[model samples]
Target: MSKQGHKTRANLPAGGFLAIGRDVTSTSDTSRSKPQVHKRELPQLSSGVLKKPRLDFSGKIPSSTPSTSSVKRAEVDDSRWRSFCAEIQIEPKQLLASLESAKEKQKPQKAARLICAAVREIIDHRKEIGSWVEEPIMCSALMLFVKMNTSFLLPHEELIEVLCSLLSTNFPTSSPGSAMAPLLLYKLLMRATDWNWRLVESFIDDSLHERQWTDRPSVDGLIVNIITAFGTRIPHESMYTACDLTYPERYRTVAEINRFTKVTDKEQKIDAFVMQMRDICERKGESAPRNLLRTMCTCAGNGNVRLLAARKMDSWLLNGKLQRYAMELLLWIASNIGQGELTEEDSETLSSLLKLRALKSKQINILFNIALKEILNNDKGMISAVAKLLLSNEFSANRFPYNMTMIHSLFSFDNRSASKVIAREIAQMLAAKEEYLRISRTFFREFVRSLLRMDFDFALFTSHLFNAATEDFSVLTIPTFFFKSLIDFCVMLPFLAITPTIREASQQRRSANGNLTQTHIDALQKFYADLRNFFEICTCFFRKHCELCTDNRLFVYSYYRVLYLAPAEYYTGIDQWPVETDVMQYMRVISDVPISEQLLCTVLEAGSDASVPIDAADTVDVIENLTKRASLSSTLTGSSMVPISTSTVLETIFRITEYKPPPTFNVQDENLPPLAVKTLYWKAWLISLIWTSLNTDTLVKEVYYNYPNLKLIMQIVLTW
Candidate 1:
């Protein structure tokens, strides 16, 4: 044999001399140090032909002569494999055979470790054989394992760790089977015994904070699926567990989660779960968990979910538990959802929220602002519904302050629609005079003030009021102050040009030609119609309760102010010339008092020039005429009327009064009629009669009791 061949032969195993496929040649000693041989290559025959080596049936084959199959078997028993089997206390082949068998029969206890091992292996080799997770065998085996070992798996934190790792690592790509990891996890959780929510929560926390699953939608979908699967199985005792499990502290709110991923359906399920828990709590007479309430609040962005959540919250609010949370959820729905989509239940929920007087002012403001926007933008009956609620008897005095602001905001958002609905409700309330009187005074004032703020067609409202009062005279029996508020609202309409402000704005809008435009003519014509309707309403009211018109000095003053301040153009070309004269005639007819010409002259003179000092004899004559008309005295004797100056008469009359003459009713405004001056002085004369005839204590009591009316009158005067 050649020296190189000898050296190769010398290096061969003791059991056999291996053959080389390549030629052996003389080479450097360093290159011949180790012989490189392909494991599969067999020793050659003596004729130098290749053939498989015969197995040695003799004592035992040399360990160094192990076949390629044995070497591969050794590689299978690597450190990872040994550790996996050791941890489960199962042999490698036994675990595999058990898993294979478990796929069919699902033997209890025997295959639990096998199933876990299979999953661990699948995850360990995720990058290479991730597709294996999608196989039917693997999926079936996993489901069976969970079914058979539910008790064991429930507390098995190690298995949970492995599954969560799989979820975190198996981020789905465009690859065909990349999503199977989450699917398998979902199926496992769904079929498993009730999960240890603590473990589940930890998983979610890790997935969100550590894995940043929210950064990847597919991964987020995986987490959402897992949560949905486990969330439904949450025990009622731990119902709030789903909240933290589904939406961890890292993702605080569903809204914040939405910023990163879309788990809308999952959030809906969580809401339903929490709501079910709330119902359970209610039945047991236990307070609902506030964490669950907070969970529902965070998830209120979903429409259907929010509706249900709103109702749940409303119940809590009514029961006076977690009212803050209930209010929060309701306001969220109101602001986020359109008013049109708001169900009647939602409206009631918001109404109930407003009814919660214990809520902070800021929360009330938020609730009302949302409701106002909803009423305006929503074509649903929310406008009418909320309007009725605001005007309802249940909206008590404690809530009145908030209700008033919300009512005004409603009108501000949509003047036309809001006012129409509100007016209709007010009219209906008027029909039930007793019930209407029961309404909050603040609400009634706000109703009137709201009407005045918007471009409401007062003609319609006044006509309704007139018809209602005519049908039932008791409808006109509201407080004199409220009646005045109504009158002030109707009489001060923008198109009527009755209030000083409207007349001033109208005068400023007149053309250079000093002629009204066609638009102005139409408005003026409509104003005449509305003014007539309003006068009809006033006539109906005064006819039934003429005492209210005559006895209430403030009422009488505003009534005469509205009647006399009416633009002259409306009553022009008619024989019943000044409407104030006609109103005075009606008053005299109703009360059997004679109309005094001296009083009319005094008003006309005051209207002609308010700055001019009245002659004392004229004032004394006016006072004597008023006193005789009032029947306080048939005539003022000279001794009784001795030395009474104009200042004394004026001070006695105007001292208790604080009303300012309207700026627009001055000589500068062309719209004011020559007889319009009677509004201030006639008001003064009638006020003096009512004041002098009535007890001073009574007058003082009326003035003091109706301070709100005084404030309202001041607002009107300033606005004018």
Candidate 2:
């Protein structure tokens, strides 16, 4: 090294740098004196240095070392090797030998490259491998290649192609294997790219073929993942908005619909319909059921398909001329199959189908109406067949009638009066049948309420229903159904005033999204009309039954206790308040009856009996109990009438006759016939009524003398 080079390199270390043919400074204490250069040659470093090269857009990593025969470990953890070795879950050598033998048996590939080429060919061709089906084989192959070569970045085009293939035309995303396919590909895409979600949005549209994104779960899920890949806790509303933004054309406004009417007037032959049914059986998917329903309905009026029951079968099938072809097909099937044709298994299947549709449907479907008609017509021992096909084990007869209140949507159709008539007739039949009555008592009140909603000709139809409803209340030994039947008549009276509340509820559901079609609006209005009329008829039936109060004290007490309540805890808003116009009918009947001496004695006995004293009325408790019952009623019938205040009965009686109530009774009494207190109240209540009716402020005492009384008086006088 030269002196100048030495000076430049001298600062590299405290010891002076060595120059060629120059003296070097001693490294240790030998340099204690002023350091003098020692003669030395320049030393070379052991490790070689090279400059790094710049990377281009190709993004390929440069090789670090020269190629060798020995296998080299790449930038991966020990677990990856463990994973690759444990793929067969066996010793590495054994797995290799097994794979080698399998490979030889399948194809005599000379090298691993040939097998790789064959796999590439399969991916390109989209063929199913020997035992592995198309989905599993392709999905696994892609997963294996990416997982093993974790650093390898796949081309965006190939990734898009793979994603697109899994979601080809008519593929069912909800099916087990199919739903998982896109998820797997999505995972692969995640591993394979640093691509933006925007890229996926652009490519997914290009990739999707036949089905719209909203139509299938897989597509929707895939699209959601694309939009929210890097996001967390996205709301459902935002997801919907994302869908609307991503695919504007598919989710057009209802006003943009070009069709004048929604009805699809397709005509298919019977053979075509059968073939469609066969396809439904062979294929696997959610779409299959919907498609099967549509195809069958499309074949309506084909050979052997007749509309025997509802004359406007076409209109019902068309269902507001669109959007309900499925229901019509189910009805058509039941009607066409007739009695004795369905096997036990077939019956079970049909019943299950009806149940599934019923659970999913919001309105009364055609299947229900058809089943009801089968029950009504009772042709060819069809009741048994209809029973087997339409009724599920989940519900006894009572629940069916309970469900029918809203399902009476068929009331909006042309057969409206007949449908109501059929329902009343069904209830009568069920009531008559011991088996049905025992099991179906749950629905006793519901059937009565539904019957009351009709365009009733009381003399012709309702008279019989009311007779059945009020049947033999004289007998304390009656089924629970009959008991509920009486309660239904009383409670339903309040509903006559609350039609506007129901109308508001119907309107909220109708116009919630501002998507109400004219057809839907009309149907809803008609349905609301049917319900309004249904509850109003209770006024007439109740007025007819006013005689019961005078005849049966037990019923009279139950009626007054259930029907009236305190004003403070009244449950309804003004809209919910039923009109009190018909109140005078039942109220006046309850208002002014004379108190008999015999009744007063009964009241004194009821009050004096320590073990049977009635509970004092608590407004809070009364309102709470009424609220619970009202909630239960709403749950059962989909709508509930506002409950009357419990205090009303006492208040009305007090205002009428200025009668004071008896002292508060014991609270813990649990005596039999549970109406002990109400009975006492009724005894006093009727006195108020009588006082009002007589228009008298007071009653004078009276005594009658008989011969026995005179003789007893003379004997007492003689003794004195």
Q: Global lDDT of each model?
A: 0.44, 0.35
Give the per-residue Cα lDDT of candidate 2 at 238.
28
Clashing pairs for predicted structure model 1, backbone only: 607-677
Q: Which candidate's TM-score is highest?
A: 1
228, model 2: CA deviation in Å?
56
Regions of candidate 2 where Cα sits further than 4 Å from its true position: 1-406, 414-465, 469-477, 497-552, 556-720
Best by lDDT: 1
lDDT of 1 by residue, 212-285 (tens): 23334434433443343322111121222322223233233111111123333555544444455345445533
